[model samples]
Target: MHKNVYTADNAAMLLIDHQVGTIGWTKSHDVEEIKKNAILLAKIATAVGMPLVLTSSMEDNAQGPLLLELDETAPEAFAARIKRAGIVNAMDDENFNSAVKATGRKKVVVAGITTEVCVVFPVLQLLDEGYEVQVVTDASASFTKIGDDAALRRIEQAGAVITSTSQIVSELAVDWTMPKGQALGKLLNLGA
Candidate 1:
């Protein structure tokens, strides 16, 4: 497989800061839509048996905790979620970084609550560390359109693939008759 390409076998997922308090700060995309797309990523990871890591920042204060639906969708990942003390950049948190490294997959699919900071910071760091990163656009949002658009441009310029939830679903599904494909089709109402 090409280094730029990501498949279920070669990819892992890293969801950052999808917390209740932080989600409301998002104005780039619909809050519910972001939640749904993020959940879809979790479901995709679960269906394909891909490794998934979830991280949150300052849950007890303002950030709140990761979405409960994410926990319910991919319980195993939720069980091992990294609860960061106050790290804005998840990759800076040793536990979060270690968890991502433990997946042993260099191709990472990432999504987060805020596009400008929460999503962009670790993505840049991951790219610097030679990881192939794909940022799910709709699954991550920001406080304003300008910030979100700027962040998307910045990451794309830095070599991370700027992609969408539907694109990832399509890339991973491949065949509608397969289990992962069928699961994704039903979830997205693709009529498989």
Candidate 2:
């Protein structure tokens, strides 16, 4: 626990701007698949009692609202998970950054719609502060494949560990022998 390693209990999951508007630019992956990944990530995080923060862009003006499935995946999050104006760029919004910090966990496991701006900005800022940052690459996408690749490359070079929703949930399980073991195995398709 010197400074860099992270544990499940010490991690917080932040989902940003996953509104309908953001989903429109998800040209790097199948839209339906992204939704499933997002839901599964949130569900696992909630089930493990991890701290979760859900944010959206411009509900009143953009995206309209977070998808119902995303909201239902983490019911304990309940309320104003929608915080951005769907600004397309929210890198400098302290409110956005502050909301993330409020969760009080230094290790951030984050994913967002659109890989370049939404996901990269927060990852860089969080890294600057010495917080252990893990970016879920498969859980995020962009308007194009190029943007997705570049964003991921930049984030990786900036010291962010590019990861995935699958890895996080699997590691947290520790074992299938525990109560949650069988369920996680089945969800992850490790069942026989």
Q: Which candidate comes out best when scored by TM-score? A: 1
Per-residue lDDT of candidate 2, residues 1-192 (tens digit): 435544557888888777777787689988888887877778877777778788777777656677778767777573757476545545456666677678788888888887787888878878887778888887888989998999999989999998877787776676777756566666678881
- Judged by whole-model lDDT over C-alpha atoms, candidate 2 comes out at 0.76
Tens-place lDDT digits, model 1, residues 59-114: 99888888999889998899889999988889999999999999999999999989
Q: Please list the residue runs of candidate 1 whose C-alpha ends up more than 4 Å from where it truly belongs after superposition.
A: 1-3
Give the number of the best model, judged by lDDT: 1
Give me the runs in candidate 2 sitting further than 4 Å from their true place: 1-5, 86-91
Q: Cα miss at 19, model 1 (Å)?
A: 0.6
**What TM value does model 1 have?**
0.96
TM-score of 2: 0.88
Worst 10 residues of 1 by lDDT: 1-10
Per-model C-alpha lDDT, please? 0.91, 0.76
